[model samples]
Target: MRVLVTEPLSEAGLALLRRDFQVDVREDLTDPEALAAAIGPYDALIVRSQTRVTARVLEAGERLKVVARAGIGLDNVDVEAATRRGILVVNAPQSNIVSAAEHTIALLLAQARNIPQAHAALRAGRWERARYQGVELAGKTLGIVGLGRVGAMVAQRALAFGMRVIAHDPYVPRERAREMGVDLMPSLEALLVQSDFVSLHLPRTPQTEGLIGAHELSLMKEGARLVNTARGGIVDEEALAKAIADGHLGGAALDVFAQEPPGDSPLFHLENVVVTPHLGAATAEAQDKAGTQIAEMVRLALAGEFVPYAVNLSAGAEVPEVVRPFLGLAERLGALCTGLADGALRSIECAFLGRIAEADTRVLTLAVLKGALSPIVHEPVSFVNAPIIAAERGIAVSEVRSTVSRDYVNLVALRAETEDGEVEVAGTLVGRRERLTQVLGFELEMAPARYMVFLTYEDRPGVIGRVGTILGEHGINIATMEVAREAAGGLALMGLTVDSPVPPDVLEEVRGAVRASAIRSIVLPA
Candidate 1:
């Protein structure tokens, strides 16, 4: 096997890669064509932020089996393109929590003490102690947003400094909050009003971009300070500058920005603001950890084992053999239920029945979550990270086991509770094939294929015929069909596997023709 190292990495990581493969080092390949040509022969590629794994490079590497990033973010890699090519993209999400948490606290203390401003003043040949008087973190209230790994660490550190810690994360369970020894606020507004300092530790996503804009800043206390070591773009820079300029906010400490290098921002000239060059994960320990972890994942992936940190796998469960065959079914069931679901997910319950239920099912349960959230979350969803994502969304998760089954020897049932309501899907393995056995409360068995349509409508005659006619008119062939209902003139669900995805116009036409209560297309990848 061959491995390519395209950027600076820890000696520990390089040594690990060298143990099993022929290694090449090329940190100076900045040209895309050069990178594309150079990457063709390597079986695995390892990189840090310095290298961009472009689509051209991935395409050129016909032998590439894995692309391992040394850090958490995939902004520098073309993950979608790699996924399309069936290349494993893996990262170390656990490498920098402590470093980022410590950095956030460092910035918080600096902001409270006006450390940067005072140092600058003293450097200019002035010892004005009276003019540099600053507040203390002791006896202050600290509010944390997005109580993920870093946020939880920050809470612990703040408590050690005698600061009262409160948090606002929609996804964190109240029990988890209690375990963290922090008060959880129901909303961000409530948290900001009660806090003397606010820190952000959330990933930047469509929903969280500019999360703390004008109105959000206005909700803060008059003397509150802000800290961001998470990502940029979550705080509106323009709004932050205005808030500081108008005396609405005390100050802000930033380690990241909406734009790298943050060229010509008004906040740069503000004495109350302190900034860093995004050094949250700059510590030696963090780099080494990230490098070695990513190296190990790449090694496993190259050996054809399931890498727990992979971004594109539908089934990452490493359960026993008896339970392994059902992992694909579990994942697909999760994805199907999630697509059919409405509103934000609130909870997920994984129920294992019959023989497989007696075995350990933690991995199976996580597969369900990974499958359900992969379609919706901006962050990469995997069995290793899905529980955290669900917690971040305040979604409760549980696993249930039963030794009895009506038909199959083993069955996996997935139930999702969203803001709207609950939806249940169950599946089993028939010989070597996975089969969808139940939906809602109706029971029927069918091996779900690649492309399918799911619909619920009034259980009356002519509805099925109208749907079939509409699909036929659109040139779609039904490969298999399964229908279920509780009573004669009530609601019924029909799932039909088709040769191709139905177009929007055709689906709309079918809905209109049959008066479908709900209808959508689902693709279960083989």
Candidate 2:
């Protein structure tokens, strides 16, 4: 076996690869074409964030069985292209947990004790003991925004410092937070209102892009401190700067930014703000762990053993091309089910029915999880950790395959059970287009759209007209509608696509007018 290393790696990792296979270190293959030309003979490739594993590059690796990322993000790699080629991509997520968690504490202590400002004042040959007086962490409240890997660690560490720890994570089970000895707030607003210090440990997703904007920052208790050791963009820089300037916030500590090497920003000039160059994962121990992890995974792939860190671990080597097209559909169904389930998720079960069931559908199961949790999670949910995240929250996941797809080439049905109720959604691919054909137990047909309305109503005279009339009355334009029912005067399901999102009050009016059994406004990006 042969392995190619396109970027600098720890000697510990290189030694491991060299022990089992021939190794080539080529740090000059920054060009995609150059990397592709040199990749044809290698069975494995390793890189950091610098290399671009494009589709053409993957195609050039004729013997490639694995692509390993020695860091956290895979932005430089084309994951979908590799999955289609039956290649495995693995990364080490655990490598940076402690580093980031420790950094969060460092920043929190710095802000609380005015360490940076005090140090700067003394360095200028001035005695300023009285001017640098700071508060103590003991008896203070530390609120964690996301209780994932880093956030969990922060809670444990903060508790040891005699700080009251409260958290807010919807996907995490209440029992889990209790086990950690942390109080989980019911909502972000609730946490903000009571916290003396707020720390963010969330990803940069559309839902979380401006999570700590003006409105959220305004909800914080007066003179409250803030810390961000997670991704940038999760907090609005402008809002944070204004809050500090207005004396509404005590101070802030930031390690990441919305843009790397950010241009002139107001946060930099604020004396109360402490910023780092995104060094959350910068530690010798972290680098060594990343290298060792990727090396072990590459070896496992070559030996045909199970590789747990693989981005497509659920995808078996025998997954057929016919079933690949429906992967997106399955994810959409899962996403839709979660959006309507209403409460903390408990379990997920997806069944593969019809001719497509002949092949293993295990790989497609992650897509369902990705869709279901992406809507609410603060991190990028991937095939690699979706199951892990589910397990951490005590959520059960199972996949069943049946050789009966009913009138279609293949059908995927997914169900998500939450604390409130169970929501089931199923869909299938028609030609190249994927459409949802079932919601709950109704046989409805509709394509996934950015804006939609899912409702159940009595099958009676004027019900359909009444729905349309109520929507029009509220100036909500219906783009399209699909309806299916059991029988005359029986219950019916209506899936409608609208020009824009249906406001809560408007949906309530429609629900009241049509006497809906249940109604939910859904948004699924097309």
Candidate 3:
């Protein structure tokens, strides 16, 4: 395999790839056109934040099978375009958790002890010791948002500092927070009112953008400090700047900005503001770990071995010796149920049966919840806080375990009930492959490929013909089609696995033509 290394990664990471592949290193392909041309002949591409993997780059690499990011975020890559082309997207989400958590603590301590300010004063020959008064972290309340891997690590460190830690992640359970020595606040407003310092650790999404704005800042106590190491837009920069300038906020330390290499902003001129160029994952250890980890994943994928970190695909319960693929199967089933359920989900029922039920299967349950709920909620979730997340959303979830064998070796069934109706999706592990076996009792088996279209209508003699005619007219060829109905003229479900995705407008047209009761087209990980 020929692998292209587009940026500087650790030698430790590059060593793994060099062992089995022909490696090409190009540390100066800053020009998009040059990068595009060079990438055409490679089987894999490795990059850091500087390089952009656009659609043109993917198109150039007709032989490309894997694109690995040596960091947590994939904002630099065109994931949608890569998925459309059936290319695997992999990232190391946990590689930098410790580094980022320690950095957040370092920034908090710097703010409290006035380390940077004091160093500047002493260098400038000003002996103003009284003006450089410092405060202790002991007993101060630290509020954390997004209690994910990084957030939990930060909470642990803050507790070691003798500080009282409180958090407001909508997805973390009360029991989990209690175990971590954090008092879970009901809302962000409650956390702001009680905390001496607030730290942000959320993703940049439509709901989280400008999460800490003027209204939220106004709710905070005067002289309270703010720290953001997550994503830039999570906090409203202008509002934060105003709060600091008006003396309502004591100080703010930001490691990320809404804009990379942020242009002149209101926060730039404030003396109390501390900024870093998005250095959350800047440590040597983190970079090496991320690079090596992603390199191994790419190697496994190219060799047809099961990759544990694949964000878009799963190999089911039976695969190269690991903690069973049942966990991944559960997650995919959760995502499927969440997609089909209507209205807001009020409850979830997860039942584990056969061999999977007899083992310690907490991870499987967590995987299912994370896959199912991540799309609808506004917080970062993991196996540790799945149940807590459900509780916070006012959704009750129940788990039933049984050892009786069923049709498959391991089966995970997820049922969600809402105002619209109840939808149940189930999946099973068959040998080395993971197959989705059932959807609301509409029995069918699919490979869970990246692109799928499901339609339910009255079973008629010409139904399949009409559907095929419309897709052919739109130039969308059917790769595989599965249809199941109880009886003639009865309710039927058709699952169409397509070679390429059906455009939104084309799907709408199909829905109109069939006069269908429900039509859902989505791209799952293949």
TM-score of each: 0.74, 0.79, 0.69
Q: List, residue by residue over 1-526, the lDDT tens digit for candidate 3.
A: 8999888888988899999999989987745678888887899998887788998988998999888888877767887688678787777766788899999999999888888888888999998789878788999999998776678889999999999999987555566678888898888899999999999888785557788999999989999999999888889899999999999999999999988879998998987777888898999999989889888988987997655565544331224243356656677778777767655567788888887777766566667777877655433344444576576555677888787856877777878876467988888877878888888679889877666788898888888988899999988889888898989899999988787877768888888988778888765522
Tens digits of per-residue lDDT for model 1 on 1-526?
A: 9999887888898899889889898987756678898998899998876578999999999999888888877767887688778798888877877898899999998998888888998999989798778898989999998777678889999999999999987555566777878998988889988999999987775457889999999999997899999888999999999999999999999999998878999999888999999899889999899888988998888888878888665323234878667767887888888767754567888999999878988878877887776655434566688888777657789999999988889889888887677888898988988888887667889887767788898899888788888899889999888888878998899989999888768988998998988888876534
Which predicted model would earn the best lDDT? 2
lDDT score of residue 160 within candidate 1: 97
Candidate 2 versus the native: TM-score?
Answer: 0.79
Candidate 2 residue-wise lDDT, 1-526, digit = tens: 9999999788899999999999999999967999999999999999986789999999999999999998776657887788888898888877778988999999999998889998999999988999888889999999999888789889999999999999998877787889899898999999999999999988775567788999999999999999998878889999999999999999899998888768888999988889888788788998899899889988988988767677665343434677768767877787788778767788999999988888877768877887777666544466777787777767899999988766777789887777777888888888989888889888878888778888888899988788889888878898899989999899888889898878778888888888999899876734
- Better TM-score candidate (1, 3): 1
Ranking 1 against 2 by lDDT, winner: 2
Would you list the clashing residue pairs of candidate 3? 173-388
lDDT of 2 at 167: 94
Better of 1 and 3 by lDDT: 1
User: Which candidate, 2 or 3, has the higher lDDT?
Assistant: 2
Candidate 1: stretches off by over 4 Å: 30-34, 314-348, 352-363, 371-412, 416-526
lDDT of each structure?
0.83, 0.85, 0.80
- Model 1 deviation from native, Cα RMSD in Å: 6.8
